[model samples]
Target: MLFNKEYYSKAFEYLLESTTYLIIGGILAVVFGLLILEYHTIWSDNWTVLITVIGWIALFKGILLLVFPKSFNRFKYLFKSKGFINFLTVFIILFGCLFIYFGFFSY
Candidate 1:
């Protein structure tokens, strides 16, 4: 629900404005990647595989954001509309709720 046009614009501006985010995000991604890679086996289970892949993607995304900020322009082109963000926000919320339910209440 947070992925609004304003959030997108501001996130883009923030990435453009300073290197602090890049540095912090990169560090956090690296840490998470290492932790997940060490603690979770990529082939052990679906959840482990999912977390491992996400960790790797996070690491790669952080690197790309740090090294090639212009790469995000493609995403800007694709999601330039407010309508898309609204739609995506609802999708994400629903997907996240499903995960939450499965994590906490599913038998």
Candidate 2:
């Protein structure tokens, strides 16, 4: 199994990159959701800003994670111990999607 190091490392790298992006994306989504909920602003005023922030966060986070995979191990341990951040993330994403859907498509 020594030969699997390459694959394992690649997998770990991708996981670290993607998870960090998702976390940052999730935070941006929530922040936008709150602004949309509280301010009643048009999507034109908020969507681009939120998306740009989230996009940049993802891009930078991916680069950082790839360059320093060791740092993410601490978060993995914290997440494993909590066991609820995943669920919270899922709920937040679902709520954000629902809000967006209703904001644009529904009266």
Candidate 3:
């Protein structure tokens, strides 16, 4: 889906059109974030800090989606921008590489 622009755009459109789906997704994100934080709240180490940050970001993103679903409409324009998509793809690739390095070689 990430590599397919048409599919990606359609999926984004579907999510934007379906309010119920957004609400449900937001609820799930909140629940998952809370659960993550519940067990890994301390930021004592790199892994703990990363987990805590992810939890916090998830919690905030869910809240934003729930409270301002309409605001996300602005992002629809971004999905159409090839530059933005390229940037996102590069970022995801780099992030994945870092994750692999940390998970395997860093140890």
Candidate 4:
């Protein structure tokens, strides 16, 4: 669903609009990647491993985006459904908020 090329025309344009954005994104990628990579290494941890893989992917994407700023331009048309995209965006935000809440208060 998210892989649809129609949705990427200007996806990271805002975040990768300038050298400052690239630098910031790169820093975040390194931190997020290390933290995620450090947290899960065992294959037995399926879900965690999945997330770790995502982290690594994020790191790689971030690095690539920073190094070759024009590369991400290719992702501009992966998806085009603004309605579904907006829905998914909201879902993700809510899901993240729930996680934050659970992380702090689940115990």
Task: Tell me how many clashing residue pairs each candidate has.
Answer: 0, 0, 0, 13
Candidate 4 Cα deviation (angstroms), residue 50: 2.3
The true-versus-predicted C-alpha distance at residue 8 of model 3, in Å, is: 0.7
Instruction: Please provide, for model 4 over 1-107, each residue's C-alpha lDDT reduced to its tens digit, 9 standing for 90 to 100.
Output: 35652435255445444667767777788778877778755565333455666778877876776688666545434334466566766778887887686668756
Q: Give the least accurate 10-residue stretch of model 2, judged by summed lDDT.
A: 76-85
- Local accuracy of candidate 3 as per-residue lDDT tens digits, 4-80: 86767667777876778888878988998899888889877575487789899999988987997777777877777
Q: Model 2, 63-85: lDDT tens per residue? A: 55546645775554434432344
Candidate 2 collision pairs: none
Cα TM-score per model = 0.67, 0.44, 0.83, 0.56
- C-alpha lDDT of all candidate models, in order: 0.68, 0.54, 0.80, 0.63
Q: Mark the regions of model 1 whose C-alpha exceeds 4 Å error after superposition.
A: 1-8, 45-48
Root-mean-square deviation of every model:
3.0, 10.6, 1.9, 5.9
Per-residue error for 87 in candidate 4, Å, reads: 5.3
TM-score result, candidate 3: 0.83
By the lDDT metric, which is better: model 1 or model 2?
1
Global CA lDDT computed for model 1: 0.68
Native-to-model Cα distance after best TM-score fit, residue 76 in candidate 1, in Å = 3.5
- What lDDT score goes with residue 6 in model 2? 44
Which tens-of-lDDT digit does each residue in 1-107 have in candidate 1?
Answer: 37347767656656654667656766787777777777864676444366678777877876777677555555654465667767778888987887787678866
Error of 1 at 90 (Å): 2.4
- RMSD of candidate 2 to the truth, in angstroms, is 10.6
